[model samples]
Target: MSGVARQIDRPRRWLVVLVVAVILFAGAVVAPSTGITRMGPFGLFAWASWLHVFGYAFLSLTLVYALLVSPDGPALSAAIVPIIVVAYGTSLELLQLLIPYRSFAVGDIFADGLGTVVVVGVWTYGQAAFAALGFRGS
Candidate 1:
């Protein structure tokens, strides 16, 4: 690692990731079209769905790391991160009900949850593999 990289702390890195994730989440929630309607005939399987997956997946990972690095972070177990991510997705769907151009779609929530789950699952598997190989970093 470079001296500059060593100078920056782990918590600071997690904070930056968390902030960017929040901004992305806010954008996805507020944007009017989000290119969903433009993907005609794709509907649930649209590029929009893929966008949600990737967006929320990164969001979930950031949130987990953020919580992990916080001073009082240990109060909330990391195991709850997936549930929190899914709940956030559901809340976003509910909020869309109030938006004129967006309707509350359960499918969107599912896509978000699926995305978070896939990412977290892969991360968990990777960590387990590393542990089995006697590698420590996660």
Candidate 2:
């Protein structure tokens, strides 16, 4: 491979590790008790549901950075981010056990997994859509 290629790819090893670290670290912080709800037709799925979209957004950003460094495409990054997220999430849940006001909620893990699926789905579809629009890449 070219030296330039090596230069680009080499940094990604640490970049991925760093991004994963930041995500995991951030998850440990207890979220303020902001009631995620709404009064719309499907209120139950409004605010809390929106969190999934935010998760997708962050995951997408992470994928873009992943691609920028390695050019491996979003699919590969999508496949890996969740494992990092889940391990970190589970650890955070366990860590919260130490707090007097918090308890582990398995539903949060399900929500996180669903959010991850959303991220992967959007990345896959986004790549397809961009290709359909005549964009292609390495």
Candidate 3:
């Protein structure tokens, strides 16, 4: 790697750190009755499942970006992002079990993991294509 390239990668290290922090915070957030937990602005808990899928998709995409930026940020393993996302989703569901109105559901976990898998697959193929085209700086 060129020295200039290495210098440019330094800033990305902080970006990866920020992304990891966001993922952790998002995973631990309490499920709200409306807003992000729901679909529309007025509807309450309407189409909540699709919200979970959407939220997790963004989270997964952020995680994939972090992995692509820095493979050795703390203990973050690119290969384990999907597993971690699924585990985080499972933990969220478990937390919901204690809430008064929230009910734990396996479907949420599936949706979250599905999001992670889709992002990971896309990132993997993107990197592969980049490499094939001689673009090595991820």
Structural similarity to truth (TM-score) of each candidate: 0.72, 0.59, 0.66
Candidate 3 has what TM-score? 0.66
Cα error, candidate 3, residue 14 (Å): 6.5
Candidate 3 residue-wise lDDT, 10-111, digit = tens: 677657646754664454465554554545545544466666666677777766665556533324556787886787778878877877767788877877
Q: State candidate 2's TM-score.
A: 0.59
RMSD of each: 4.4, 4.7, 5.1
Best by TM-score: 1
Model 1 segments more than 4 A misplaced: 1-14, 28-31, 38-44, 68-78
**What is the TM-score (0 to 1) of candidate 1?**
0.72
User: What local lDDT score does residue 81 receive in model 3, on the 0 to 100 scale?
Assistant: 78
lDDT (tens digit, per residue) of candidate 2 on 36-67? 54632355555544553355346545644564
Error of 1 at 87 (Å): 1.1
**Better model by lDDT: candidate 1 vs candidate 3:** 1
The 10 consecutive residues of candidate 3 with the worst lDDT sum are 68-77
In model 1, the clashing pairs are none
Count of backbone clashes for each model? 0, 0, 0
Highest-lDDT candidate:
1
